[model samples]
Target: MFCFLIDIITYMHSNTFHIIIGPTIVKSIYSGELTYDSDQFFRTGNTNSYYYQAIDIIVNITGNYTVKSNSTIDTFGYLYIYSFNKTKLSINQVTKNDDKSGSLQFTLISALQSGVRYIVIVTTYSPDVRGPFSITVSGPATVGFHVNTAATKPSSSVTTTTRTTTTTTRTTTTTTRTTTTTTRTTTTTSKASTTSTTST
Candidate 1:
């Protein structure tokens, strides 16, 4: 008068998934020196005399990153999106910092995308200054640095443009100073009531 049911199931499938989160490298340190042989560039808003070194930044994950420098020299940092053109100092600039980490060091923060090429430019705040330095990058993944070996300088056209601008600026300043001096002399002469004052 009682009934019993039994069922057996068989399955054939298997899969494995590995997901990695967070930074693979907590901090990556790279040391280098900006010597006389290092590439140089005229930093934006600066004269053409600062020695600089360019490093290619490669990452495996997309996230925010912080780049800091440790050096005895007054350090300046620049972040570029794709490529850096020494002829055009600001063409691909994302951000730049100076002394943000204190003690003449710099700290730069920006969001970086995986598979995208980025360039970090390390230069000095003072012209022709050179010394050894170490840069540390902290981000979502280990950052790879490849030193760019290409020597860079402003293009001929850019050089011509810079010379023209400098000449124009100097001429303008000279004219302005001369005019001011003339005006001041006229005013003094008009105020002078005695012949001796006017003669002097």
Candidate 2:
């Protein structure tokens, strides 16, 4: 005699799973009009300023970014990426570290909406030589569960007596001298991390 069986599972969870896996956003340096220099910063104004790329997001996101200096100027910078539709909403704004030779990298610890476009960049003030900046964001990762049936053995053959035993041991106390305990836990997990960019 032969037996065949199948197991199907359905799960419900937050669509935002990027918090797992790696950061949804992998950081990278801007290619042009940006570098780690302390002298050429003021070319635009006394407080060296410049905007890098625009990030288009489907939802309102909250993450941190950093602006750093690579020279020994011991200087700091600020990040203010405002939204086009909401002038008062600063998509990203914060101060980075004190490393004279490291670029700024900030993190945003908040939630995002359904549809919003954002700007991500940095502007700093120091002696006058600058070029190079990078931004990174955290998001959810995607994962899936599957059932495999690829084998040479007959698929309908029962390997042993199969049992889905959910054993919850509970302790029972006897009239005057004994105790018992029970354990209960159920887990079904999923994924995160996805990124896309557009001009804003």
Candidate 3:
């Protein structure tokens, strides 16, 4: 004769996927999921427990979809989800596991929306060292925020030009009287003329 003992924790979300929140052992929990023991701790103290929603999604024709779950100072780490932004979406933080072992999952669901994009960023808090928040995205993909700053306009358009010019005019006159030169009838005359050129 022989006796054996094992444990497993499986959690499911409506309209979403399933996850093993605790130890994943291949055993038949034929004791048949012992009644939810109120005194039973999922892990330990505030450092080791989490709460999750039974339902995973709600969809709107168009808009932003956001989901979030935070962790205690003890169990802060990367946040995980099923898939990101079937439409525009945002994912918040991670919640702790009861035993100082696991983390919580937050889910946001939405239909495809026009002119909108989605992304999920996974970041860590104190005591838990991880890389910069991992980002997941779809449709106009990005690893960062998208606000479409380039599409904005400041004001209407108008053009202007300027021109300047200067002009100068000069006048002069010369008069000669010759009443005495007619008496002699033999007057000799020589006239010298001077010329000047002006440029503009």
TM-score per prediction, in order, is 0.62, 0.30, 0.17
Query: lDDT values of the candidates?
Result: 0.73, 0.31, 0.26
TM-score winner between candidates 1 and 3: 1
Error of 3 at 83 (Å): 20
By lDDT, the better pick of 1 and 3 is 1
Query: What TM-score does candidate 1 get on C-alpha atoms?
Result: 0.62
Q: List the residue pairs that clash in candidate 1.
A: none
| Model 3 Cα lDDT, one tens digit per residue, 1-200 | 11222223233311222232332111100000111121112222343222111112212233332333333322222222443321222343222222233353233333334443332232223322322111122221111232212222221211122222222222333344456544445778999999999999
Candidate ordering by TM-score (highest first): 1, 2, 3
lDDT of 2 by residue, 1-200 (tens): 11223333334321221112223442322222233321222323344343222223223334342222232323343323334212222335432233434443333333333333333333334334344433333333111111121211111111112223232323333234346888999897877778988998
Identify the candidate with maximal lDDT. Answer: 1
Error of 2 at 168 (Å): 15
Output the lDDT of residue 162, model 2: 21
Q: Report lDDT (Cα) of residue 152, candidate 2.
A: 17
**What number of clashing residue pairs does each candidate have, in the order they appear?**
0, 49, 8
TM-score of 2: 0.30
